[model samples]
Target: MAAQKNAGDKDTEEKKKEKVLRRPPEEEIIIRGGKGASIRRKEIGPESEVPSGTGKVAGGNAPANGEALAVHKEVAVKVDHLSMKFNLSQEKLDSLKEWFIKFLKRDIKYDEFWALKDINFTLYKGERLGILGLNGAGKSTLLKAIAGVYKPTEGSVYRKGVLAPLLELGAGFDMQYTARENIYLYGAVLGYSKEFIDSKFDEIIKFSELQKFIDVPLKNYSSGMKTRLGFAICTAVDPDILILDEVLSVGDAKFRKKSEKKITSMFSSDVTVLFVSHSLAQVRRICDKAMILDHGKLLAYGDVEEIADRYEEMTEK
Candidate 1:
């Protein structure tokens, strides 16, 4: 009986040792400042007792730990009441005698042309807003205003974040310079640091598929080739806000498809896109909302389908 009791005592001791060995060490989680308060922890099993120095498990109402990531933050771009106008003057300078005669007559003619009149819109992050209109509908002008290239004549334009504009195929490119040199120059003109351009150089070249001709001067490049390079460079540095003005039409069919895919990928990120296109079908496919402009005036702005239907109705009338 004593031998059996001794064996039972040994078994009890082993059970106590196993319980001690299975216990986890006390865990302390420290959250650094910068992001808002609230650190989350996973729940422990009910059978296990939490030790001192360990934080309490977060409740179900608490946000997930992934919510603290930077990508979860929201951003927006606002463009308020932007308008532009150009003044044209008609003045004739004649011979010395005629100039004196005209001075005596004191005649002058001036005309005011409004390019964009009281344009207003806001683009929240991750939104793809399409601007559609006819040839002289001020679509390009509105894009330039938003890009800060053209100051408004009457109203104000306010953008909340960084803006990347692809207004022209090669707006700042120097024909005399090599493609590599032009890349730096254009990047600088677009407000990118030299360091950024250097880092993105290889990616830009790869995307353009022009590594073979990157050493050649831009003047020697075909229009389509130049367009490809320009598009690649413009898109390499993802900006908070992106403006595109009829630039997608510059390349061939295949390149255009590639550009479209690139743009789609960008939209998937936190980028806000303001796109101007003459292709109504393409606009319908890519845009959740659309604005219709006619002769420097906003005819309609709302849901993509509703605006498109209204625009078609106006055109048919």
Candidate 2:
């Protein structure tokens, strides 16, 4: 009889054990479809662990030193002590001739610029992290590092899923080409195939609200016009990870709000967003977490409210 009682207790304990990041047996999986199929899941496991006092969390949920970091069974992006450096020449050499002459005499001089310094952070799947700093504060440099446009001088960044960066507006655009032609050109830069661009062509046109101006030469369009179209094209397709750098500031108030709505909708899916903006209000609205940087160093990293408060305090003083 005692043996039977012990077996019953063991069975109960075994039943209590569950899989990590899995819903309870009674919970149901929700699937939705439109452009693509999406599964709604209840976030379980160590993801709910609160951050440590300094914004770095420890314990079992914390990531290892160099592993494919998983904070709670899901990691969208991981940046490990990332840094970037550039060298600026002391003297201006207007032409190749001047540079060659300086090289022959061994008189080239440069000052090292550390654009970013030992910055470390992580973004879980479906998280929006806003980066805030004043001008010349390495905000854009950090975004460029994550986008793989500029190689890091030290440390590394690991990202899963397809990434779409709205870093430079119309980077590959041809001034002589028409708006319609530039779509194919910029689309290619964004990693979209010709067929995909063709299918989404009309959708992009309508969203930009530039149908009448679609066939006009890009050189003739105003800066705002170009911004509208570029924003429309980049946001048209859903990205697993999105990076935005000052792209929203060019548009008007109404258009900016429209773009915000589009970005806000991304939150419904498992999309990780990284952005740098001077507009603290916009960042606070779109991102739950914010990282404050000053002079190439991390000043604060925490909830948007905390970081924003810290930033305001610094700026005010």
Candidate 3:
């Protein structure tokens, strides 16, 4: 009887151990497609320690491997320790007397917010890098920094080739001007020669599928039409380095498909692409490597599938 009791107790303990080792099924959530896939929230194992003297991250610290160094040899764009900060301010309403007093002192109250901090990465010719992060994670800020629209508060960016950023389409477009006139205006902003713009004018109009409205004022066109025209004109100029934000998501499905094909073709060519998108599937399809940013810091940078898995894990939280 004593032996039997001991055996039963051992069995119970073994069963408990087995249950503790088991993990629950991961829940799937679809963003924009077929059956939603479950987010993988598994902790990643440590990668092999790369040798020293390889490359560097933000703040001028060398990376574990020569990843950035190797890319710099082949590509023209190198971002090093890029950071941006914005000042937040609010007006204080005091008594009229207090306000007058403060006005005499010329004192102001404000708080500083870091929009991007210590962002470091490298891009090579013909490499497509995808940037993934939630809103306010500094996606747009990074692009603007690379485009030279916002100078980094810290660190520096190095560009070896001409960069054409499709950030804000029609950013320089004159609403009152006809598409023909805006073509010259927008083309010049993108670094195109007048002759080049003249040569590509018909092609741009044709690709936009807005030839019928090409002579009309840009303000007269619908939003979709405007987006199509803008995209066509911007992308028509062949660029060595292209930065694409979520702007491609503006057009209709047919136009979107066409734009996708155009982008794929560009990817196949020598053009280096820095793409920012929330669509993991699209990112996986186009990018060979991806980087995840959270609160202005890089969480991971590596193979697209691996990074995507890590990103999904993070979202599950």
Clashing pairs in 3: 55-63, 56-63
**Best of the two (1, 3) by lDDT:** 3
> Least lDDT summed over 10 consecutive residues: which range in candidate 2?
20-29
Clashes of each: 0, 0, 2
For model 3 the local lDDT of residue 252 reads: 79
Best by lDDT: 2
Q: What are the runs in model 3 whose C-alpha is more than 4 Å off?
A: 1-72, 92-103
Error of 3 at 123 (Å): 1.3
1-317: candidate 1 lDDT, tens digit per residue: 11112232455356445533222211111111122422222221121212221121112111233433323333244444556777765655546776678778885456788888776554545767789788889999888776666766765444434566787886568899999998888888776777778878999999999999989998999988888888998897766678888877778889989999998888876687888987788888888778888889876666677878877787788
Residue-wise C-alpha lDDT for candidate 3, range 162-218, written one tens digit per residue: 466888765667899998888888878776777778778899889888878878998
List the candidates' TM-scores in order: 0.71, 0.77, 0.75
TM-score order, best first, reads: 2, 3, 1
What's the C-alpha lDDT at position 182 in model 3?
A: 88
By TM-score, the best candidate is 2
In candidate 2, what are the lDDT values of residues 56-131, reduced to their tens digit?
A: 4322223333333344445666666777778898888879999999999999988998888888776777878889
Question: What do the candidate models score in CA lDDT, each in turn?
Answer: 0.67, 0.71, 0.68
